[model samples]
Target: MTAPASLRDHAYQTLKRRIVEVQLRPGARLVERDLAAELDVSRIPLREALRMLAAEGLVLLVPAKGALVATFSPADVRDLFDIREVLESLAARLAAERATPDTLAPLTHRMAEARTATVSGDLRRIAAANAAFHAEIIAMAANPLLSNVMGPLAARTEWLFRLTASRDPVEQCSEHEELYGHIASGAADEAATSAFAHIAAGRELSITLAEKWSDPDFDPELIARGRRRRRVES
Candidate 1:
């Protein structure tokens, strides 16, 4: 018989899904007692899950303030995309040099799904398919270290995409198709160039949307004060 998942694993998956889907918005406080009760898990496992999330850059643990969803600034967005562009571009180049027909097949299928999602105007599906397509490229590269580094960044990218909701799905799918062609043909330089352009475009869109949606009066000090008061009350 298969072993049951541990409580910590379950909590981590559930909380990560919620965070990625924006059920837990940026900067939302995660009270351990409430979350433990909600998930029907004890505090010990929940705390372990929170630590894992924090390590992945999805959660922030203040000294006495418990956990909160990680917040993004324009600088943060820029930094993330900058690193993503470099790493993903390298991944594309490596995939172009290494990928076989079998490795490329999954990306081709995902591109079709992304195209359909684009036409249907399903943002969530578009996002998922897009992420899957890129993930396939990373897998094709066959570097464990690269995969490990890109994993959390990919999750953060998903969160940014959901928050912005600004990508043109049709354009994105077209770009992916182009990128796939380059990789399939073993055009390493072209594949790297295409990947960099794709991520650079996304970075701009994310930054623009972030600026539009950001609160004008958002004060970190005020939030810290509120957290302190809550801690005192509890």
Candidate 2:
């Protein structure tokens, strides 16, 4: 028989999922007492789980206020995007060179599904589809090093993509189509260039629109701390 999962493992995965799915936005408080009671586990396991997430850059610790989700300011947004640009450029280049027809087919399916999901405007499916698209490409790169490099950054990248999706989503989907074509044509450098620009544009849009999402409920402390990005509002 399979052994039961540990409490700390359960707590870690549940909390991580909640944060990545934006149920716990950046700077959203994680009240230990409330969470332990709600999760029906003792504080010990919950605290342990939180410590794990903190190491992963998903949760933040405070001297007195407990842990909250980590907030991204304009600088953080650009830095993360710059790193992804480097990593993804390499991934795209390698995928084009290394991907067989069998490998390419899966990525094509993933992108097509993502495009369909985007056209339908179902945010939940869009999130899943987007992950599938990126993951398929990452896998096609056939580099263990790329996956190792991305393991820690994956959660934050997903959060950033969700933020990007909230902005000019149609443009984002169209870029994915262009990327698909470039990769299909065996243009590694071209695909890399297009993917880099697409990702960079999304990152810029996320930072520029960051203030519009701030409110008392979403993240009061960050709302107070973040300078408005100054985009024209409709």
Candidate 3:
């Protein structure tokens, strides 16, 4: 028999993935009764899962009302990128400083995977590959504290990556290649500079869309879908 903790964890991962993938769009109401029925879990475990998501800033719980999917704004995007710039740059520097063929293998593979996905021209695949590349870089840093700090922000980071999928994948992939060259060559300073520059370029685009999304008339559904279509067309 499954323990209560197991059920709760299962519900948490499912809900977290749905939210990150934007299947549960920003600002969507999460009715406990409906969610419990849909997930085929008891209200107790479902609520536990929601509380975990809430702690991660993916859900908002009201005192009297139920929960709602957390919404992002221009300020939020700015804040997120600001944190990322600092953290990711440090990771890149550490990765470069500690560079060895063995440590760099996964990043190399991730870059190759990203290039393949870019050539395939599937937006979702491209986004996933891009995220994996960054994750591999973080892992290469060999800093458990840094990884723990970044772990919670993964969902939000992926959501932003999806929103900005319209950006030129070729150019982004090229940037990653350059960063990889720096790390591979053990150029710590160059690696850090490259990482900061890459994130700074993406930051502007994210902030722009977030600003546009602030308009009440803007359709939230288009956040991922429309941008993705535009990329494919281009």
Candidate 4:
């Protein structure tokens, strides 16, 4: 049977969303046959979808065993946060300059939703709402380059933020609310600074937790496998 034109596109987006949403955890092996069946697509198109994720650094292609979700080291998370600080700082500044009532309204709604979701004790909804809030704010900058620069970093940081579910949600909700207030009020520098502080605080907390409760029995072979894939890709 000939594949539909949207077959590969659907697989690519489905896999990417799953990866970014952390449904596919880091170092989790992806079985091709299972993925094909799950996606209701042929293995041929699924392979292309995997390649797309590899290019974006969301999935790693092992030499023989094929692809798995990419893992984050503390070092990797730190590097990502550093990049995010720079890119998002610029985004905040531009968003301040470019923001309109129309644009900011959606962000405001999401921000409020985020706070309510946190209070309602719905971790998954809070996570989704939080992501939506920040994403819409960044989008106000209207610069493709800025969004492109921050996308992967944001994606990688999400797993760390998931740790927040176990901690205080009000703190996070408050942080975003304050940042959004600054953006809405056209306090450009204030918004940017607050954004940085928010991200930095999360980075610090996540780093500490990662150290305290790190995986005790990590797979050395997996690390080597990841390293070899990097070498080949390079």
- Residue-level lDDT for 193 in candidate 3: 98
lDDT of 1: 0.79
Ranking by TM-score: 1, 3, 2, 4
TM-score (all chains, Cα) for each model? 0.87, 0.82, 0.86, 0.82
Judged by lDDT, which candidate is best? 3
Pull out the clashing pairs in model 3. Answer: none
Residue pairs of candidate 4 with colliding backbone atoms: none
RMSD of 4: 5.6
Instruction: Give the Å error, residue 65, model 3.
Output: 1.2
Clashing pairs in 2: none
Worst 10-residue lDDT window for candidate 2 reads: 225-234
Q: lDDT tens string, model 2, 32-138? A: 76787777778888888888888878888765546777776666777888888888888888888876788899998998898898889987668768767877778
For residues 1-234, could you state the per-residue lDDT of candidate 3 as single tens digits? 333998899889888877776677666667776677777799899989988998888887765566767787788899999999999999999999999989999999999999999999988788889989998899999999999999888778877777677899999999999999999999999999999999999888888888765555543344322222111000
RMSD of each: 4.3, 6.8, 6.7, 5.6
Question: Weakest 10 consecutive residues, lDDT, candidate 3?
Answer: 225-234
lDDT by residue (tens digit), candidate 1, 133-200: 88888888888999999987877777776676666777888899899999999999999999999988
Instruction: Report lDDT (CA) for all predictions.
Output: 0.79, 0.75, 0.83, 0.71
Which residue runs of candidate 3 sit more than 4 Å off their true CA positions?
1-3, 215-234
Those runs of model 2 whose alpha carbons end farther than 4 Å from true positions after fitting are 1-6, 63-65, 212-234
